[model samples]
Target: MSFWRAVLAIIFPPLSVLGKGCGSFFIVFLLWICGWVPGVIAALVILNNPER
Candidate 1:
């Protein structure tokens, strides 16, 4: 992930993964609603995926 994306993921997980896909965005958004850490983790995983 890029530096800004990493930072964005930490600050706002769902937004960071917005370009990933609708499914990913929703997943991160839901995880964000549940808790902060999960959302960040999900965003990072999705963003880091080479096959996205």
Candidate 2:
């Protein structure tokens, strides 16, 4: 659900901070600027990925 996704975006930024093919640091930075939800989602997605 979006609620949980948003929550994940807050807890872990590096995973959910989706950007224009940017690196982790950039993604994290963007996520921080955007808000907590984006960060958590980025972090979660990154963590969820098996290939990392």
Candidate 3:
């Protein structure tokens, strides 16, 4: 991920991974709705995991 993306992930988790595809966006969005911290954590994990 780029510097701006990292920044976006921190500020708004769901918007940051939009380019990653619909599934990722949906998962992150759900996590975000559940809780702020979990969503950020999920976004970071998903962003880091290339295999996903």
Candidate 4:
């Protein structure tokens, strides 16, 4: 993942994954609702995946 994206993921997880797809956005959004840490973690994991 790019440095900016990782920063974005840290600040706003769901927004960072906006381009990934609807499902990913929703997943991150839900995770964000449950807890900020989970959302950030999920966004980073998703962003780090080479096979988007």
Candidate 5:
């Protein structure tokens, strides 16, 4: 993940993973609604995905 992306993921998780895909965005957004920590974790995982 880029430095800014990592920072963004911690600050506002969903936006960090926006370009990852609709599915990824939806997943992170939902997790965000549930709780910010889960959302941050999800965003980091999606953003750091190896296949990207």
Candidate 6:
């Protein structure tokens, strides 16, 4: 992942730019940075939830 993308994941804990090209790894990292609940929520939204 890109440096800024990783930084973004750390700060936002699941909120990265859409199609930022970071992928699931970024989501997992974000979860690790934050916690389980936030991580799972982020992953679900990123992986399954549609754009609104």
Ranking by lDDT: 4, 1, 5, 3, 2, 6
Write candidate 2's Cα lDDT for 3-25 as tens digits.
66446466656544453246865
Cα-based lDDT for every prediction: 0.96, 0.59, 0.90, 0.98, 0.93, 0.56
Error of 3 at 12 (Å): 0.6
Poorest stretch of ten by lDDT in candidate 3: 43-52
Which stretches of model 3 miss by more than 4 angstroms? Answer: none
After TM-score superposition, the amount by which residue 50's alpha carbon in candidate 6 deviates from its true location, in angstroms, is 4.7
Q: Please provide, for model 6 over 1-28, each residue's C-alpha lDDT reduced to its tens digit, 9 standing for 90 to 100.
A: 4566555644654554445356665766
In lDDT terms, how accurate is model 1? 0.96
lDDT per residue as tens, model 3, 1-52 = 7888888888999999898899999999999999988889989888888785
Please state the error at residue 16 of candidate 2 in Å. 11
Which runs in model 1 stand beyond 4 Å of their true positions? none
In the range 1-52, model 4's lDDT, one tens digit per residue, is 8999999999999999999999999999999999999999999999999999
Weakest 10 consecutive residues of candidate 1 by summed lDDT: 16-25
Q: Candidate 3, residue 25: CA error in Å?
A: 0.3
Residue 39 CA displacement from its true place in model 2, Å: 0.6
Residue 48 lDDT in model 4?
93
